[model samples]
Target chain A: MSCFILEQAGIDAPETLADVLAAAETIRDAGIMQHPVAMVSGAGWNLAQEFVNLYLGHGGSFFEPGSAAPAINNDAGLATLEALKALTSFSNPDYLTFDSNSIQALWEAGEVALMLHWGSRGAGILSGDNAAPEIVEATVLAAAPTVEGQSRPATTLWWDGFTIAANTSDADAEASFLAMLNGITPERVAANSELAVWLGEGYQPTPASAGVIASAEGGAAPYPMTPYMGLMHTALGDNLAGFLQGTASAEETLETIEAAYVTAARAQGFLN
Target chain B: MKHRTFFWFILPSLIAMILFIALPVGSVFVQSLHVEHEQVLRTVENCGPFGCTEETVIDRAATEELRAAQPLGRFAGLSNYTDRNHLAFSELGVMWERSDSFADFTRRAMTLPFWRAMAFTLTFTFVVTPLVLLLGLAIALGVNALPRAFRGPTIFVSLLPMIVTPLIGSLILFWMVDSRGVLGAALQTLMNDPNLSLKASPTLTWIMLMVYGVWSSAPFAFIVFYAGLQTVPEEPLEAAMIDGASRWQRIRYVVIPHLMPLAVFITLMQLMDNFRVFEPIVGFQAQANATSLSYNIFNYLRGDAAQFGAAATTSMLTILGVVVLLTPVLMRTWRDFNRKGH
Candidate 1:
């Protein structure tokens, strides 16, 4: 699961996207931190994933019902892009080069006060040798802020599970399933609860797991599982940077993404 | 040599080329003409730790039945090449018809992935090839002029860029050119602009990629020319010296002519290598700013749902690009060979 990880030393935790943006000026004016937010707009699929979180927060869906036609070139899409551009105004100038690894580095170095990252990174941030002591002590995990009138946090839900291969024998599949079941038993889950935000019985919530739990309880939607969503993701990842760079408008960028997705969908037989 | 004897001598290599090179390319061409069958979709409850939600999933049994019946997938013909992700012929026509000016047309065209990658690839190939040749020749000459005792260390030091792996070299440079990194900080101070980020701008990223291309590849041309320098006989030099030629004149006259063939060889190799530029873009994570045909193919094949048809089409297009780029050099070499024979 992913949610907002904020450094609380400089300011109270932001509860809404407006609060986050509003806090940026106060933090900068008071000489607390120049950039309060760290977002990825440049490399990898994380940017697209983040975009989906923001778009869904604005009540947007990826496709028309029962079809592969893209429905993102709408008001929600434009609002999401505009919000992202506003957030970037308070982020580092080198935000275009930001990816998972680099943003994590910035967080650990205490350069950025807020970031949206995976909960699995909690262990490293809490006890990693590279992280500054003050930053570690001040770090707080919370559900990502939502847009106005939205109760759910601006984030998506994800889960990790085990599955047996189709080619495995019946006996082997049974053994594999038994092993996985044993691994996630209540007793074992209680013992290793701090390692992750576990959903197994007897697992207790820790500060590190707070964000994921809160987000799940707040009705964060799961990422879309449509077959053609992968193509949409690739198109979004490839094209969104142009808008963030100020070279393309939100409409133009969304149009490019739709065109790209349609072409890829046609090639993959998801569209004619 | 007898024709039959020559044919028998090259028989092993000919078979190896056919098996390794020709067959794979032929299969890629065939794959480019087909696409996956239309998927059968079904809504199912996907239970997980975070409760069950109705999700759209591929109906595996139905899809598998379709695949089993027609294993090669639905035939797509040349539609993959004409799609917006590849050549984008129809999109280009739209851009031409709708745009108000030539610059507007070009700007709209660059928004297409195929044209965007092509712009970077062609620019990288054309810019880096000549720079590599010039820098390599300069280094070769400077090293050749060094004292015999210092030459060994100098040559070794100069070859370090090529000796280091390209990916690692680019990654190190990527770090150094970060906004807060040593080189990046120094560049910012020098330019008197706090916001001068090398990775943020497309033009800067293109320049950095080409700079890396030249830095890593110059050593290859240098070593080739250095070896050729050793073979430049003393007879012409002595004659030129006796005829009152200056040092620059001697080099311009005799040394350059002797190195002409080696320059041609280096140019041929460099053009092919630069046209397929891939590693540095990935290492630097510059895909947002610059992507080559090879990078496009890599992108198509990556992630959960690999577009095999798109990847194959890009592969064929890349092969075609390399052939077109090399044709002039190949024809010139052939003409030179014929002239010498005559």
Candidate 2:
């Protein structure tokens, strides 16, 4: 969808999804040519290419790619893609790459236009030099795109919470835990921004309980809590690395990684 | 008067060692047994506008939650040392069972990374030790053979790398191995391939790491061997040469035996240093899998949540492994030294 928007906007060339994928392969094989794709992890590289394929496959245009979905199907997918492309190409022609640390550095340097980073990244970026105070002025968080014309974007939520050990001998353990939980309120969330910059876009408060921390702000999407997250993360990271390094074709890499992920999930009883 | 002077001569070093070395080791042992936690609290006065309360106190709890999460007894004996808990078969998928016992937890936490690291450390020790020794011996011999005027400069040059901090050497290696750095640029230019990455392939990563390791280490070995070479008896080598022995034969029979003790001493030092190889591995792994045992230990200790107990157990196991592996060499060296003394 983003590719279609890019094509429609004259940001990306028009080509069929298959042709675009083939072209991406050719470019990848040419290996870090005009602009090296700076993928944060192997999973990211796979997802990026997968996204390009999905966009082109949906009858998206090459020229003004971002306009394709909006023109052909009256969808906002092209608009979203255009927004993302505009973000990536804001300061430079280089494709946006997501390395947790490097992206933080870029944000601090005020070099990044549109950074797709964690909530923590936003915080760090804002705190770095305070050069671009406007970035945090009206920060908004949106779910990532799922498919063309899809109204809801699939937002990735990473839940980190404190759990009390059932056998905790410390008499004050529960009290301390409760205090910490109480400290996680919206006011505390705002205060936390002073300590560390979270992108502040999707800042929300949740119950200080040991479950999924859903957003206090309505319309915020939550991540599914699953036991297989660790394995998925590892597999995704490996595949992303392999793709970025050109060790495997993007399609092959994705298929292999996704299959492995499924097998792991099944073994872990995450799937039957 | 002489006895008093001797005591005075060694007293400073003894005091320094007691203060710097013995004290730190003792402190670490003490710290390992006790759990430490830091809690921050804003006093009513400091809390500005918050009413003061005598009961206002914040306490932080630091305990081993993962182990305590089960109905496991505290400090259970060697029951935690079994196969079920062990990570020896982790690659076989035995260790990944969801409902792991406390022993299994300990095994996974302490044993797996420990053994893996020990194996890597051992491999690193064996590979690097001999190379350093042989290279050092060669350089020492070459320098020793040089005209006395050139020997000083040559020895100084050999000592340069050793004199630099290992961390600095590692940092330099990191830059050199970076894809956009000197060695990578040179390789790219030579191969006419811009995409060639020294860190991308595991084999290449290892090769670069080994090269950096050898480069950083060779100087130390050379310095030791050079110093040892200075003690080599000239008469025996001269006699061997006078007896129509070739240069190689003279070196083989006379010089080598003369330098054997020093060579062994240098080898042992190299082995110890290389076994705990951490800095280079850390630098290398920023772009590649050059992780060594020490680096793994460091990572485990500095992980998101510091698993102190596990870290302690791992450290203990690492110490034990090193002792076990090096015992024979240490004994042999001791016995050889005793025999030579006699």
Name the top DockQ candidate: 1
**Which consecutive 10 residues in model 2 chain B have the weakest lDDT in total?**
B42-51
| True-structure RMSD, every candidate | 2.2, 13.6
Measured against the true two-chain complex, the DockQ scores of the candidates, in the order shown, are: 0.72, 0.05
What is candidate 2's lDDT per residue for A16-118, written digit by digit as tens? 2233333333443444222212212212332333333333333332212211111222233244233333222222221222346654554444343223444
Superposed model 1: Cα runs more than 4 Å off? A1-11
Instruction: Give lDDT tens digits, candidate 2, residues B1-342.
Output: 599999999999999999997786565444334332222222222111122223222222322343244322133232122212112454325435632686554333322334445545676678778888888788888998899899888888888878878778877776675555688789889999765667666557666666666778888878877777777787887888789999999888887887777777776777777777888765554322344656655653542234343344445455656677678888999897798777
Index of the highest-lDDT prediction: 1
lDDT of candidate 1 over A1-272, digit per residue (tens) = 11223333445668888888877766767677777778766555877887998999998999998788899999999999999888888888778778877888888887877777766676677775778787777687878788998888888887777878899999999999999999999999999888887877989998778888888888888778789999999999998888888778899899999999988888777888
Once fitted onto the true fold, the runs of candidate 2 whose alpha carbons sit more than 4 angstroms away are A1-36, A42-272, B1-73, B76-116, B286-288, B337-342
Q: Candidate 2: lDDT of A210?
A: 7
**Candidate 1, pairs of clashing residues:** none
Give TM-scores for every candidate, taking all chains together and pairing residue i with residue i.
Answer: 0.97, 0.56
Cand 2, B chain, TM: 0.72
lDDT of each residue in B140-225, candidate 1, tens digit only = 99999999999999999999999999999999999999998999999999999977889888899999999999999999999999
